[model samples]
Target: MDHLPPHPGADAAESRVAARADAYAAAPLLGCLLREVARPVTDEPGVHLLPGCGKLLRVRGGRRPAAPEVRTAGGWHRLDHAELVKLVAEELRRHTGLSNHELPAEMADSRDTVAALLTARARATAPADPYLRSEQCLLTGHPHHPAPKARGGGPAATWLPYAPEAHARFPLTLLGVREDAVVEEGDCSALDALGAAPPGYRLLPAHPWQLDLAAAGLAGAFADGRLIRLGTTTCDTWPTAAIRTVYAPERDLFLKFSLDVRITNDIRRLWRHDLRKLIRTDTAVRAAFAALDGPAAWLSDRGYRTADFAFEELAVLVRDGLRGHLVPGATPYLAAGLVEGFDGSPLDGPADPAAWWEAYLGRLVPPVLAAFAGHGVVLEAHLQNCLIACDGDGVPVQALFRDAEGVKLPPGTDRAAGWERLVYCLVVNHLMELAEALAERHPGLDPWPAVRRELARHDLPEIPALLTAPTLPAKTNLLLRWTGADGAAAHYRPLPNPLAGA
Candidate 1:
């Protein structure tokens, strides 16, 4: 057979996809390096000096920076994603005086994962529901993390079917744990509604991906009759931005499971310690939200169920559904999703930018502050943990916070530590990202002033120091990963606070 010539159109399309993936992946990696370690040259625009290597690095664009180049003896050399990863690894080694083979590979894996997701997304149809669409729209996640999309450096085939970015949805793998082996806490009655459990077994729905990942460890339980496969859920559940959590609109329930994969900062497994403290943390948050006089709500992590043998691995948490908490005539969208943006995002083309931003701040800021000041419950109000509900006109009217596992309570966590955490999650992580996105979309919008005013309205003692502080604590994800720090242990670097002068 004669060899056929390669089609120019197809080749060009593939090249475009690769280039886009590179840009998408590079933005977060560059943002992390610049924010966490590099110092900018005051006189040179777009140029930053990597203090570790004493090298000048430059990038193009803000918000989502791109086109990374390093200054060499001969001149400047642009780097592809692979070269960028190598550069980052080398810089980190020099800066931290540590050699880490793992993080560099994760950085590469994250970029490769983006390429795969881009390709998969092109073939898949987007979810019709705007909420689900918003949840799945994060192509470039955690803008300051080195490996936001790294799925344990596994093959795409292993993770893509369950990936939110791919707009993928699948049924939960239903399993039945023997009555004696079943371990549960709090209200897990909603779980029984998923499917029927035979005579002496309790219905335990599991993430299929987790099952595959831990098959070897779970073999003894399966073989010993402690756990048995009971088929799958009748309705498909959409995976949220938090990949391990799945939402079933039909049942109006959220099921969080243990996935033995390193996503961003953690392994994403429901740790035993956190699981044990679920009820206490959730109760504190619930009481705080109930006492507050507003539309802000809390999606309680009602309870969790697991096999006694595989407590952490098989654990699945049941969270309160949306319908009951959301305001009438309002539609809920993930806060992180709003920043990432989707087809129906309210952030897109707002009629009145100032009014829109004010409404958003009104809905989001108060509950977080009240939860801390009034009730001593520090809610993790980071972007991923929050949901904003918009009315028919797409004006934000409500803010709902979830994930009791991330919440901090008094005594156990000192007041000062909890306050610092609240500021980081609510102000630095959540509001700052949203404000940047809004300001980027609408050039004249000065979101910090509204943030300053909204925060000032809150009478908390920390408010004054927060507003005038020269710098704010920003989590150092890149350095954390490089140093192999405990994923839950957060390290921070001071970032110039826009709130200071605003």
Candidate 2:
């Protein structure tokens, strides 16, 4: 090669160093990233007034100045305490924009991880997972056994070779051979089955570092002593659903762009009341609508030394960030996309009147009522909020409660809106979804009885028997499109169930 006057590498390296220096020198950026070496922390005046003392985010300062000192910085800072909070939040938001943008190579995959995440979901009615070892991933696959048989089969019969450090200090399990492939339970497989290698077959759980590439821009712990970029390769645990973008250097997390956020139940009384301000329609009175139509704030409530919510310490490397603890796995948790469900009104059309009732009144009702006494929380028991998830054996074993927002507690017992919203959220809203799902599954089952049983289980104060009820079918018709025969869909079909007493 022709000898250049100077190797470009030297100049490029110098340029990078100078640029970094300039970034630190920038006052606003520097100010936001400043840390308090000795300042006394101060809580918001009214922050302690709120329940759980609305999380106190660490202030970026050498030490929090005294109230008088902070006031002197601007006595108005004291006058507008709420405004200070608002401004800090706004400024903290600006800091999410970092000095540099570097897409990490570790979590990158040619095929999106969403394909494998289909099974990462937690069900309202969870099926018994046989793959999960009783207490540990000890080979022999039993919970307590440390035998090597759990890792017995070779690459053809199984994948994961005997790796001591697989996950949770336990070896990842191989369920069976599928299509000449060693299908590792609760993990990715097809990649290794492509003849990758012998030991390569050992499955790797989601690595925590992936968050640096995945989060909007590592928020927490970035502005402190060291700018630690925390991210989650959210796509790594997902095997289903579509991902629009990981959007590195742009957004922190990957979202199913098409999802509707309104489904999440918001509990703020102000937001709740403001919804029905203009309309008298029942549509204006619903709970799911509030969650779906929200510009909901996604924040980490847990506090840490990090300027922002110390997501680095709290966000699981592999677990779904929001309401993710519901799923169990190693510390290298599986990732579930913080996605919104597509909204088209899951309850808009009824499949079969008799089936709907059979599912609603028969199979689904009895157990849901029992959920209240069993769980200490009367779940919203609404449509779309309950999964009715089944196990490998196709039996309902658990009810995955989606929104704690709509849960019920007897009046004077503690909980806003007490029982009014509770009844609606639980029996009316949540159960409707269960009823619709049940009817779709079994057409012959009577939904009315289950409704009665579910109500009975809850000790309902009143029954629709004497009152002019909204024609049982019409009650559900408003939600579903399926109408039973005779142009009048209010009919009965009993759902099949062997276990009633239980």
Candidate 3:
């Protein structure tokens, strides 16, 4: 593994920060390795036997496991973040008969990125808005993925100013697309209100980071007068957990841009193929939510606008603001943020753990199942894509799901395949993480029973099989990255189902 050199002015405090960053980075990588590649040794708690090299691996803690160690001829030796990466690479190569040169570097980069984020977070003030605070609280993102914090291996300076975990808020660079060169669909009239466009031009807002990354491809357009630079937005926008997407409080708008950076599993560009089908997918989700009888809501992706010449590179998608869909006086918090605790998280200390867990399940589970069974639409109800809104008393009153780009329709994808995708996102990625967090916070609280009961309440045909199934499908993120598979092409392995006997 290529270790990042120590900071030039490193001190005792910086050394402590490095230690914390190592712990933070190692947890997800360890979780991924244990889940996807290692098997538990019978009657040995926290001990796993690697099948490939017959090595015994041990870790401490559950949920976010830490302090990985490997038993060797001499004795048991602990592995630091770099050594852990090396161990993982060796094990994966022996197990899969393949060598991955890139993932190790990403693992190192992720660790270095965490170190930078930790330092920045210490110096920066947290957002006063609870909702914004919740959105920006994901320091250890995607707890099951190996390199969740990897920022395309770029220097920290390039991405730090836009990182949500650092409490970043900045103005967007506005541009003018020549009237005839503008491409748009659906309801994109909201873009016009951001700024004034000169005669024969349309206002186009761009993420400054994306503009910087795509500067080479866009130079010709700037010189040829197809795109002109306008001044930045007067009001600043907050970057959400999804770094490319920003929330503008001044206009009560959410704008998603085509970022060139690879965050978590994918290079998060707004690809043209997905954009062409955006309306169809968003409409299906909207109709499903409209027909459902509950407090569940769908935040619509209204439309997108970009220059025809630079479609994917310059695309900006406009999404619905929170005010319209949220329950009266209810505050919405990112579900992922709730798992990764924030200053004012509702999950931190609920008055009644049972009631809170049930209320959470009641609000979140129904809509996802209903969308799939009742309307043949599979909503990506993962934690990051979901927002749970709480009433004045800290009760979960509503569940709002967004990101239409991740939605799957029936005929395009077979029902069985779509159902599998839904199960992974909704049950595994979303509920399992929340359940673990809730259970960890409140000792002696068995979260599985409530989850099983919630699944039973749903009338969908898949519920019975899901509740009784011995194993639930879990996406193999570590193996996927090691094998250099396409990020969107999900590969799942069977994980023991906790709901089986609950």
Task: Give the Cα lDDT of each candidate.
Answer: 0.92, 0.25, 0.93
Better of 1 and 3 by lDDT: 3
Alpha-carbon lDDT of model 3: 0.93
Give the 10-residue window scoring lowest on summed lDDT in candidate 3: 6-15
- Residue 260 in candidate 3 has what lDDT? 93
lDDT of 3 by residue, 363-478 (tens): 99988988898889988889899999999888999999999999999789898899999999999999999999999999899999999998898788888899999999999999
Error of 3 at 137 (Å): 0.6
Candidate 2, residue 486: Cα displacement in angstroms equals: 42
So what's the TM-score on candidate 1?
A: 0.98
> If the candidates were sorted by their TM-score against the true structure, best first, what order would they fall in?
1, 3, 2
* Candidate 3: count of backbone clashes, pairs at least 3 residues apart or interchain: 0
Best by lDDT: 3
TM-score for predicted model 3 compared with the true structure: 0.97
Clashes of each: 0, 62, 0
RMSD of 3: 3.1
lDDT of 2 by residue, 143-192 (tens): 11011011111221121111211212211111111122222221123223
TM-score of predicted structure 2:
0.29
Comparing 2 and 3 by lDDT, which wins? 3
Every model: Cα RMSD to truth: 1.4, 24.3, 3.1
Model 1, residue 380: C-alpha shift (Å): 0.8
